[model samples]
Target: MRTLQVELGERSYPIYIGAGILDSIGELCAKHGISKKSPHLIVTDDKVGPHYLDSVVSRLKSEGYHVLTHVVPSGESSKSLDVYEQVMTTAIQAKLDRSSAVFALGGGVVGDLAGFVAATYMRGITFVQIPTTILAHDSSVGGKVAVNHPLAKNMIGAFHQPVMVLYDVDTLKSLPAREVSSGLAEMVKHGLILDKDFAYWCCENGHKLLALDAETLIHGLERGCAIKADVVSKDEREGGLRAILNLGHTIGHAIEAVGGYGRFLHGEAIAIGMAGSAMLAERLGRDESLYGETIRMLKAVNLPVQLPQDVSIDQIMDAMQHDKKFTEGQMVFIVPEAIGSVSIVKDVPVEAVRSVVEQLKGEG
Candidate 1:
């Protein structure tokens, strides 16, 4: 097992990554100071419940911990206020208290929903993340929890860090082909924003990663998580240095909102958004090669680099207008300055963004 730390001083936490670590969750909980005397809630989804929920529940119960389970239907739609309220209702009836902790037992959706519950329940409680999807390697680490507002993705959210993050690589083996591609998009983003060699390394190892080779997959996930941990540790509140993490999120979140949170997965939307950011950089006359390089890296892992023709540019623009990143009538963008660096440009013109979106649609 490999352990990484999110050093926030008093609020710091540890991230444990390994194969078959789910069995040790109960012991880990006790080690992390989670009290067995309190009733705990485990929030998961229909898809994940059948596979690992029983084992998780059994493990916690064996350790003398009182457990409650709330399973929601899987997908982006579950991250809604309606569903959030339903889970809260369960928590209230179960009488979960401040000493209790919430365990997120599925993918990003479960993590976000459960974490939001933990954050707001009784004005905040402890939460743990057990991410089953590779795409969650990003979402599970950072404390950015939220339910969609229909108008924008993650519009209603908070920065509540987890007490610990338990990642069992075994969970990733069950992912479908498209999901694997979607997850790697964030791994690629990590490289693009911070590590040049790792960016190209991802491209070179695309086939191995897609095949789910144990060594390569774990290495990639560890690197991705480490990069995220390093960033969140320095700028816990996204005051300054942390905005770099939004490299593709500005356009990506808009795509999810315009799609009604159903068409593309989060990472897929971010893939196209990253491509658009590179193109935006080119439009600003930084470096023409950046676009081609970004596209190559995305294609290496089989991610979409262009917007679908059916998605209206006007609708995308309207969605961006509602994005939290949009302020004072100007679109904020994290434009790529190079393969491994980005600039948070706050005064981006609306027409330039439209031109880039149009150009993306024109790509074959």
Candidate 2:
């Protein structure tokens, strides 16, 4: 097992990544000071519940922790106010208290929803993340939790860090091909924004990652998590330096909103957004090669570098207008200055953004 720390002083936490570590969850919770006397809630989804819910419940119960499980239908749609209320109802009915902790037992959706519940329940409670999807490597670490508003992705959210993140690589083995590709987009984003060599390494090892090679996958996940941990530790509230983490999120969130949160997975939308960011970089005369390099890296993992033909540019623009990143009357963008660096440029002209979106749609 490999352990990484998100050093936030009093609020710091550990991230444990390994194969079959789910078996040790109960013991880990005990070690972390979670109360066995209090009722705990485990929020998952229909897809993850059948595979791991029973085992997780059994483990916690064996440790004398009163466990409650609530499974919602899987997908982006589950991250909604409606589901949040339903889970809150479950928690209320279960009589969860401040001493209780919420365990997120699925992918990013479960983590986001469960974390949001923990953040708002009784004004805040402890939460743990057990990420089962590759895309979750990004969402599970940062305390950024939210439910989507109709106008924008993650419009309703908070920065509530987890007590711990338990990642069992075994869970990733069951992911679908498209999901794998989607997850790689975030992994690649980590390198793209912070590590030049790592970015190139991702491209070179793309095939091994896609095949789920044990050593390569774990190493990549660790690096990705470490980068995120380092950033979150320094700028816990995204006051500065942390916005770099949103390298593709500006355009990406808009894509998800315009698509109604059902069309493209989060990472897929981010992939297109990153590609668009690179193009915007060139348009701003930063580096012409950035676009090609980013395209190569994204293509290495089979991520979409272009917007879908049917998605309307005007709709995407309207979605961006509602994005939290949109400041004043200008669009904020994370434009790549190089393969491994980005600049958070504000007040980007609307026409330039439209031009980039048009170009993205024109891509074959």
Candidate 3:
């Protein structure tokens, strides 16, 4: 087992990454003053609930903790005001309080929903993240929790860090290939923003990494989470440095909103968004080699580098305007100068944005 710590002064937490950590969740919580008699809310989805929820409940129950399970439909659509309300209702029925804890037992959706529930319940209770999907490697770490608004993705959320992140690699064995690809997009994003060597490592190890090679997945995820944890420690609220993590999120979130929440997975949309951002960088006279390498790497991993065929420039631009990156009515972009380096460019011209969007329109 490899352990990484998110150093947040008084709010410091440890992320335990390895196999079978899920079974030891009860003892971990106990270390934090939570015992089996404490009320524990296990939030998951229909797809993931069947696979591992029982184990968590059984473990907690064996330790004598009161456990309540709330399983929602499995998908991005569940990240909405309606679904958030339903989970809130379930928590109320479970008698959750300031002393209670919420354990998110699924992927990003469950993590976001459960974290938000914990953040707001009784004005905020502690929450632990037990992520089932590799995609949660990004969402699980940063405490950036939120349900989606109709206008934008993650527009409605908070910066509530998890008390503990118990990532069991064994849970990823059942994930589909597409899910694996989606998760790696963030790994690629992490490499692009922080470590050039890691970005190259991803492309070099692409096949084995996506094939669910245990060592590759564990090492890649630990590195990605460590990068994010370092960033969050410095800028927990995205005051400055943290925004770099939104490398592809601006155009990427727009792509997701245009697709009506279920069209593409989060990482898939970000894959295209990263491609678009890199194209915009190229238009600004950034290195051509970096642009080509990024696209090549994405394609090598079977990720989308273009918008959906039916999606248009106008639709994407309209959605982009709603992104949180905009300041003083100008859209801010986190552009890559090369893998491992990025620039925050604001007041980007619409014509310049259109040029890249136009190039990718029919390419899909």
Tens-place lDDT per residue, model 3, 232-253, is: 9999987889989988888788
Score candidate 1 by TM-score against the native.
Answer: 0.95
Clashing pairs in 3: 36-64, 36-65
Off by over 4 Å in 2: 324-329
C-alpha RMSD in Å of predicted model 3 compared with the true structure: 1.9
Backbone clashes, candidate 2: 0
* Alpha-carbon local distance difference test for all models: 0.90, 0.91, 0.86
TM-score of 2: 0.95
Give the local distance difference test score of model 3: 0.86
Error in Å for residue 179 of model 3: 1.3
Candidate 1 segments whose C-alpha is farther than 4 A from its true place: 324-330
Per-candidate TM-scores read 0.95, 0.95, 0.95
lDDT per residue (tens digit) for residues 1-364 in model 2 = 9998889898889999988899999999999999988999999999999999999999989988899999999988899999999999999999999999999998999999999999999999999999998889999987999998765567799989899999999888889999999999999999999999999999999999999887788888989999988888889888988999888887888898787777888889999999999989998999889999999999999999999789999898887777655665667788899998888888788788889989999942
